[model samples]
Target: MTENATGGEVTFADMRLRPELLDVLSALGYEEPTPIQKEAIPPLTEGRDLLGQAATGTGKTAAFALPVLERLTPQGDGAGPVALVLVPTRELAIQVSEAFHRYGRILGARVLPMYGGAPFGRQLQAIKRGVDVVVATPGRALDHIGRGTLDLEGLRTVVLDEADEMLDMGFADDIEAILAATPATRQTVLFSATLPPRIDGIARRHLSDPVRIEMGHTAGEGRETTPLVEQSAYLVARAHKPAALGRLLDIEAPTAAIIFCRTRDEVDQLTETMNGRGHRAEALHGGMEQEQRDRVMSRLRAGTADLLIATDVAARGLDIEQLTHVVNYNVPSAPESYVHRIGRVGRAGREGVALTLVEPREHRMLKAIERVTRQRIPVERLPTVADLQARRMELTRAALEECLLQDDLESFHAVVESLTDEFDLMEVALAAVKLAHESSGATPDEEEIPEVAPRAVDKRRGPRESAHDGERYQRGPGGGMTRLFFSVGRSAGIRPQDLVGAIAGESSLSGRDIGAIEIADRFSLVEVPQAAADEVIAALRQATIKGRRPTVRRERDTRGRRPR
Candidate 1:
């Protein structure tokens, strides 16, 4: 292993990777190993179980991927797959699979990324032909296992990437089942951004004699670590978030930005709204096909698209070099999630901005995140119409300056000279500037977003608590919650996670926003925010639950009348 005399910097060459992998790393311009990578590769290459805690953009992918490639067996050994990597989302599965392919190019590694929403026949054929590595989502991995298409007896290594995210997506049971199918002697490695108690329980149960490593934002920086991200929030009412976001984007004028939303519907809605406002915006969510997603990403990377409005799951594992801003459309459900979202930007020593739109009710949630992250996120006033006009004038002035310096204006000098003869020189210049400003597609925002103050609450009461009490009558953070009835329940093998995932996947309500759920023998009742009740009902009516469309409706009283 090669290291500098100071013993602080270690090159990828020092990691003892094979010649092929080293050459690929060099070609990719990777000089040294990240903190997580440096500490993990050694133990992992030695076949020891590992539990690593590092946030996004910390190079954890290379840490696990390089080791997996280093230990790959030769092809045509009749071994289905020597390595199995389970991720939370299909995007991450594809990303990790591509990394393995890139690093293992010289080894002729047969790597496959298996996930839902792709052609099943192709994945099945790939497995039948034989693969050295399989990177897959937990649910799809379980599907193949049940179909007898994926055999784990020959597996030598099992990696759970983004382990906490999988659990949050209701894949814990599926992960446990897949792990149970793998060989007990196989090397197990789990990586998560946070070490919650549930994560610890999984580590205790799955990893044996593991090497534990924990490093977050301050990894290798010690107490002097400083975040490069400028975090701020805007206190706008729920109804004005779209306008506020549009105004903020106009003033900020970022090179590129990723706006995170909670659900697929929200992503689509915001994408359309932003596009109408003259921004080249794109939507990415679970509903999009693989091909469509590839097109969106290509457009963004090629500089044709400026805004990527995406759901949390679909946007996982994406790192864009030119990203300058990260906007939270709503307060994140969890504080750890806030950390992960902001981590996407402010990387590689580049300054980045993190902006958020906070509704009155979500102020408390935002405060909780601040307390957890130990960072103060000052709420800023939304930009007014006057601010927008000034920003547009500035942009027009800069554009005109660039044109005068670079463009061939000699051709238009004759027209200007002729006009100057009939008009004052200053008047002609003002006319020219006005035409330039108008042609630049600068539309002034008229209405001002109403500002809302945070609700003052008694010290004893919670922010979300309503006047009513009892588990049966609980409300969401916003207001009262309404219970909806589904025809299928325990008999159809329905679980809470299944319902949570279904609602969260289809509607604007997140899993955290959902209230108590009761599953009976033949029916189920789930509580959603009262304001979102109709939307949830409409979405569920259109979606299938457990492969069957269940009759959905607002629960009624014993008299068969709707509850008031």
Candidate 2:
């Protein structure tokens, strides 16, 4: 799970599952249970409450899903749902629901995925008809419960999948409400990638003497071990990021990759740019409808698209088997976020790569991520045009070698003989290789990316790092700082911590990146890095501040006037 291969090759059959389930596992080509599953299934099947911490692709779903199905009982015609799974987003809800369906189909289990954007009538009808399991997002699940259409009193088991993500999305209250409605004696299982204090509080309050399991990356004692992922970063100016990313992808030749951006606007723009550069890229964000998102996912899984350009929230809970690379368009604002994004690749013991594009000014935040993750992310130079050319030539050579191995050359022998008759044999072979390279679609590289070095941070000045040095209310992009205006202030119960948390949660900025804060009667002003100003504004626009849609933008110069 943590780029390390799962523990000893323990087969699913060794777990004593139902013969039918074992048969299905074999049919599906599943060889063994992952580390989480190996440790979790026995206790879960015994009906013990569990609190599991695992990364994204750790097979946690099966660890819980199989037990839920194994314990499933035959319900009466109008019985309430027996099991409930709460995920963070509609995409995850659908994905988890599909997994339950696939694994439980032979058992005649009824599963429903309830989320917003779908017709309420459909979900209502399905619930009334009765189901064995219901996979739902917290908000929509609470909505049904409030409407008196969903009954949780009969639930024998309740699962909080991706509990940390749900809490981050402000579903803590809804989760508490939903759990309160469930049977008090029911088995509770909480799975989170990271267990913060808040998650611990939930587990203590809800679970009854739960069994705890920690999987994925864990720092050792006073020593640094290499992560399973090949982590690296490139410090480049913002303008050259797109080109640099394209160059890196060409050199890596990833089987499939996901490029994470800060906002939907960024996802869209980069998706278009990557596609124009001839990469089969797809964009996924909260802005798209469920159907559109499903189509994009289908294409990627079917190998029609090799690159997925997505926002963080939209790509949650996705497990793509062929994914070999994860790219951070910008360094993550939160250190935990860096762990989550790269966890998508290098899973289940496969070698994978994690790439990041860091701007010169954001170097300090990158260091913060490294400190938190306890892994060194080497800042490597961008691949030059010459490097790209050499990679392309290598690819051409490999392709020709494969063709020679797999293709019959009898037909080409006649053409080769004809060409060699009029020219030297060596010259004819050179001409053929040139034609093969050209026909292989190796585009000529014309530009070299400018090199950039991270700005030196003066540790004596503390982490603020000249964040308040120049024009406190500068409107446009530059080096020092830019003032951002917010609509909510003291009246909305806004505080400086609230401002910092909002920006840090939504954008690729940490607490260290924010400078001074000025809260007025009707609005607030915060200084953020000029380099990340646009990204922060874009991310915040898509988010709510202090439970209100605050108008966020650059601070207008008002040197001589009193604040409104």
Candidate 3:
């Protein structure tokens, strides 16, 4: 197995793939095959059943997709797919389908993705018309087959991507059932990050004389020793995470990134928080519809959305072109999950960064991942205000230089000439630069996010004692919900949904975490679960109610009601 220099140069020609695929690869600027691509493509192209162990971002999609495209002869007026790629999640099914479409444009391969959330009618129609490839989640694929909407009789290749995850999600029966329907002579391939006995059992049962390829194939560099994922972890308190994440993003300044959160609520909340901080971020989770998911992906691919905050399941199989960073909002529950999250970056000779926020209590989880991966995730401190200032200055300087290069001075000469008569040229230039800097979106007035205890606290505590409004009653007599008072109310045209959306977006809390809402003409009272009151307040500090900043604080009671 050959590894190009760490992110080195090579060509699809070296792999001796089909000439049509080579042309498409060249057009896509795929100058070299990734480790998995280089290794797996050869045997796969020869129509061999194979088992591959590779993580995401290892170019596994291309590894399998390219060979499938190559072996496919022109369809002879057939309505059934020649190849099938089965993934564990709907997001993955769509991503894999897109990859096939991308790589096989020259071959005129008709690729379709079928999954549960989407309208069944569309998938049914596509299959009826005809398709070259079908990428589907196991359950949805089985559902179609049962309804006689999808036919697998003519399948030439069947790929089980993330085979272990499918089994873990309880799709083993569906997979077995699907395979049973496909011809026994069909080529069977399986790719996974790790091989449990379950995966081994599937390979043994399904594959015939399969070729095995492992992913950590490194060439001349010592990259195998360090690994290219640039893994790191941060020890952060739960309360400070929102502010801390903002500060770190300012320093890192990723081209595009995926921030992994554990739950749909966290994904939505972080998505909102990032947007509030002047970031273009999209949220993806199970709660979102197929249409919403499509729009989020479209925005991300169009480069209009830079940050994608998603839960693990929602992010499965995504392969974005300019993604440079992967941030885990919290350490994942399992080492395999950590592996999967970071696998989204460090693809195809790209230098990628993987950052994880580790609560003190979750430090063990991080270390466990380290033990499994056999690489230490360095703990990084949050960037300071001075550091952010330096980054901003660098950005401002870069922006100014770029504009100077691209903009013609002929038109702007009049303004500079007019200002030069009153002020020195140097002073005038500095003033113009100040205006550009002001519009650059860097907040020089950003205060530092306070540090919390070195170790994580078991129970939520106020980050600081409330210094404004009524006395805080966070932990009520019954220890359930605490009422918060916002200075803006019905007069400001704020509704419960607005408050709920804002709270869910800005803070770590979800809509369900909030209890009751009482709105008056000039003021409002809302009950939030006791534990998250401080976090909600922290998130709101950087937010606006009715496009204006308002006082949001813990209320002593909801008794006071007054009209505007």
Candidate 4:
């Protein structure tokens, strides 16, 4: 580290990063190292174990990724990846893998992200072909190791990104098993948002003499709110979300935006619906092939598409320079995921907006997110019809001004003169504007987007409603879901996937739409859209589960709430 001419604050150029990485950094417009990067990079490059405490968007990925890439072996045939980064989710695995690929691109680094739901054959092929670094979720990495398809004998570094989250997702055993497989001398690194006991236990077990680095707002400073984005949410019922989102977009008029949905089904449906509403929208999800994902990204980057409707997993690690807005179609299940979603916007010191569409039922999740982030997410009313029309007129006025300033009007003056001879000049101008407004594809019907009535929060427990609170679990969001009780449970060797597959095979509903599955020794509760509840119940009765018919009934009935 070198001293700044004025003080001792060193820049990234002063750090001992490889020249190629520096070049990439410069090309990417990274002027200085973030605090975590400043402290963690040096030790990491020196081949030391690192335990870093940093939140998402604090540049933790690069803290570990770049050092691992720098330690890669010179290009040559190798048994397997030299570096392994275990992440909590498929989205993160893909994101970290891409980061390593980008930083190491100049050095011809080969990186692969291993995760579930993706085709096993494709992952296997990539593993067999050889790679320099493997960024994976613990479960998939272990699966490959068990099949003897992934070789870790050549490993030199092992890093755990979001260590706490990995533990939260119940991958502690998988992480331990994977760690045990790696060489004893391998350098280990662990990064987490908070160092809970479990994370500390893992660090003690694996990370030897690790350098620790923590990054975030200082304690006692106290947060007014997360200061990056102008965060707001709308209480729009599920049925009116599409219309509400359209109206919100009209008000926002963002250069580019990402509309986050919970599932591929929603992403596909929303993308299709948004396009129908005259927006240039695209769909991205794990269900699509890599080629399709690349195509969608190409369009987004080329400015042909302005809106990306994607699931959290598919949109992970995506950095769009023109991204001016991030919309949550539904409140995220976890607050950390919410942080990651909005982190995509309000970056690089630019003012950006984040809007979430919350149903009355999900008001609790909104509160939960606010509590976790130590800030209040201001809830806003849905835009009225008059508001939408005013915004449309404002946009029309701006467009006309731009045209007048830049476009040559000499060709149209004669036409204007002839029209002036027949009509008033103001009337001619109004006619031209009317034609422009009509041709601009703005919503013709300025109907108000319906708003969801605000759900009153219970003073003691917040906005969450439980079983006694109207059996709300039976009444899922959109008021179209029912929880069905099943007689067969663990004693009968029933699994969640088994219940999922059985219902999906017997009915029109896919497993993705299934929610809130609970399995017990003698019974199980499965939630499906109310419209399909009877159909699912009927189909399950006729179709044998585990080769036998199991009693299935709607939990809507009190007796059905108990095991048959």
Candidate 5:
């Protein structure tokens, strides 16, 4: 590790990182460490307790996971977990566990994920058999401890991930109990987005002479002070949002952009809508299988999918260097979330753009975001049909200019000369230009997209809050049936089969318990027996359907009737 002139730490290439882990990072195109990683990794590898203050998507997981892998003992048959990671949500648990698995694969590390709605018996068996690392949610881990199914005697490191979110969710007691159960001498690492009083208290009580690392954005001389993201918004009527978004895409023509929706059904619907508009769009949510999610990401990285419609949770730790834009299909509810969403772009000093589609009512939230970032987000008018045509024509002209400059036109010159005898030279040139424009689909027509009234902002709705809420599902009169609503639909590249398969496989529920599924443009509604609603929701909560998380809740009927 090297210290910079500004007293900030830097990770040098010569610093030790496991060869296998480095190989994986190289394969993933991660060359340098993030600021947090540079400061946190050295101390963590030295077995010192660490309290890190950094927000999500800062590459903190790797900062800790690398140390954990470096310090853990080799696996033996049924040797019990050596490193334990506690997270707030099951999705996070799975994500952390996968990270450990990916980094430790060459070391033959056995990583197991234990969370609610998963088979407790299977998890218990895995614990009994032994694992190098255990990633679990606090509630479920505590349950395992109480049942004497998990052993922490051999633990070498304990990581409290997203500590602030856990505290916010009222898991302080559970966390304390789990910490007390672990060995007193074990190294403890706590990572939180904010160092609130509660987190400070935990650090004082749990960590011994720990190193504190904080990272902040700094303005440098001759270096750009602005964030890499060129932030902007488009004002449009609620009903014309889809059209507006499509038109904007047509104009900007980003190589790749992630369109963020608040709910899984919204991701699905938006993906479908974009696809219908002749864009190669894909949807990613939590309700999908790990394998399917991998495929979607593969396609995105391979440039097969230009637009990815996703939810915040489902897109965590997603690093796409080719990404040139981020579209907030809905304004984020919180400033922190907005920061994370836009942070995906504007990385490594690359120029990027963040485009938010703000409805009339969301203007206030947009203002709040600007205030928090201390940056002015320029508001722009929605793209008009004429504007789109102009942009497309410009693109067509640019492509033709490039062809004329670089292409070997000798072969085409003979063909052009033959046609010149019968056709006027200007006429032939116009015809060629017209053919090029048409082939590129750069010609725009004047068909207006149908508008839908903007629905009232659902105060109770959001990806994180609704993740664990039980009220999103409704039970039938007989108490035997339940229906859940997803904010994703056909437009988000979601199918009924994707929802059914995800719930049935990831949860303790069966296919017979799942009933009808209705997919729309911005959302989808699925019915399951009331007996299995909770289990299905918990199961799908962590699962990624269509490479995003299905904001699963009890469905409210068209008449506004909710299941009992």
Candidate 6:
């Protein structure tokens, strides 16, 4: 169903939202409703069951969330959980819960997120106090139900988000059980990227005659061409990829992009490597907590993060309008996955670019992708010094053009006038332009990004230790000193680099500030500058490394003997 034109003005004013919510959104600068929100909000507000098919990053969360907020009653005397949202992953559960909290804060609406990995006592406590909304993953929600800690008897609305992913992850039975427990008369909404048969069965079984809204496709038209996507690929040795990718990014300089990798470990390593090369990069994978993922996405959306290295599963359903590029760090196993990866860009009639880094052996897979998509992905060569220079010049010219278009140049005229009197007008103009361009790294003669060996195929925890050896070494604490720990020597998977990275990324401490890290299976010790110990512990408390929270704190002395 299309959005009714009548509600346009009201729909646009998320500011008219409850005062607290308006403050949050306004502070966050969310000024407009995405297309999904425009179409889904009205019907949902009317209490109609809905089946919405939309891509990731289309603001689907706000689409369903706004209506949920509008319909929810305050928690003052409710026995509920008035609204229940079931997501596939713990990360999504937290994200949706946070959204509900943000939107309903002014209304005094209470929302709780329940998921695995977190201690159950916190969830139980929150439930006992009463919640207007519960955002949960299927497995943990079902656990709560079986334990009698969660009651859905008062639930008014039930939402199944990313239903297909849940099904894919083997949670279909759990989903069915959860839906069965909810009241039969409740308003049911299911949102998925695709309507596979499994999803169709779920809809038929649960939803009363629903209004279906499928965005991105016209009634009679065939699949629309991704005219905005400028598809290209490069052949490089596996060892040369990092350097090649860095160079490509340097030349293209996408406003935002997600570099898709095959594994979580790869995501972390690539993110660190990219950051070292001076790109504002972040990593997203299942290994991170919901809060961390949210922060990473926030950074990406806010332009604080220019490159996001992530696994496909972690990046699923991510829609970032500012994303102008999609890079395949490794060839995807299937062509459909490739399509989904690149589709993240070239959306909503905006131009986008997709680049795939293909190893020699993956040429056949590339050909297979071409066969399935019915489009030829042109092979491109690595950028040479000349090409890099030309690209920088183009960027400089673009910046100058933009500056000329703006109205804030009156104060700068004096500087230009004084310089013009002292030198030839053309030379002065060029010099001033050169200074501005150089400040932005738009200099044609800027040093080339170093060519590291292509990333080696190692099953180890870090990059290759030697220039020629494929054996990767974990990153050590940067400073010569090491922090002593009392907890290590037994159970934790704590490693030297793990301690260093966790401290450096999560805390205010720089890589140079961290000294040395020593890890044992049960407990581990790290070395950081004494001055930054408190900050390091505080940061570690919030960081999730290797799927578990690090118990980082100052080491208490057990014996009189201390190592010098």
Model 5 scores what on Cα lDDT?
0.74
Q: In candidate 3, how many Å is residue 117 off?
A: 1.4
Q: Per-prediction RMSD in angstroms?
A: 12.4, 13.6, 18.1, 12.4, 14.5, 16.0
- The clash numbers for all candidates, in the given order, read 0, 0, 0, 1, 38, 17
Candidate 5 lDDT over residue span 1-564, tens digit each: 347666654443444876776776655435356657778888998999999876554568888999888776667335678789987666667778898888788888899998767777798787777788999877677767877888899888999987866665446767899999999999999998668899999999999999998644332221322476789987666678888888888888999999988667678778898899899998898667899899999999999999989877689999998999999987775565678888888888888989998765455456656656777888876666777778888988999999999978888898899999999999999999999989987645655544322211222112331322131222112345666788777667665445544564456543334555556667877777777777677766655555466688787674367544
Ordered from best to worst TM-score, the candidate numbers read 1, 4, 5, 2, 3, 6
Candidate with the greatest TM-score versus the true structure: 1
| Candidate 5 accuracy as TM-score | 0.53
lDDT tens readout by residue for model 4, 115-193: 6555679988887788889888766677788779889888989988877656544466678899999999999999886
Candidate 5 lDDT trough over 10 residues, lowest sum: 453-462
TM-score of each: 0.57, 0.52, 0.49, 0.55, 0.53, 0.47
Which regions of candidate 2 fall more than 4 Å away from where they truly are?
A: 1-9, 75-79, 217-390, 393-436, 439-564
Over 1-564, each residue of candidate 6 has an lDDT whose tens digit, in order, gives 323356443434532445555555554435445556767777888899999876544567878887788777655447668889988666567778888877778788898987655667998999988888899877667778977999899888999997765654446666788888999889999998668788899989899889898754433221343867999988776777897898899898999989998656678789899998789999998667999999999999989999999877688889998999999997765566678888889888888999998875355456656656777899887887778877777888888999889978998888888888889999988887788778776544544433222211121124312322112233333545545453533344434444444443345443334444444446666666667676666645644544455566677653464542
User: Can you write out model 3's per-residue Cα lDDT over 1-564, one digit (the tens) per residue?
Assistant: 354456544457766778898777755545356667777888988899999877554568898998888888886238999998988666567678888988888788999997655667787788778998999876667767877888887899999997755654446667888999999889999997667798899999999999998654322222233366897777777788988888888889999999987656677788899999999999998667899999999999899998999877678889997999999888765465677778778777778999988765455455546656777788876788999988888988998898889977789899889989999999998988788888988788887776533221112222232333332322223347777788887667665545654564355553345666666777777788778888778767745554556788888545655321
**Candidate 4 global lDDT:** 0.75
lDDT of 1 at 494: 70
CA lDDT scores, all candidates in order: 0.78, 0.77, 0.74, 0.75, 0.74, 0.71
TM-score of candidate 6 relative to the true fold: 0.47
TM-score of 4: 0.55
TM-score of 3: 0.49
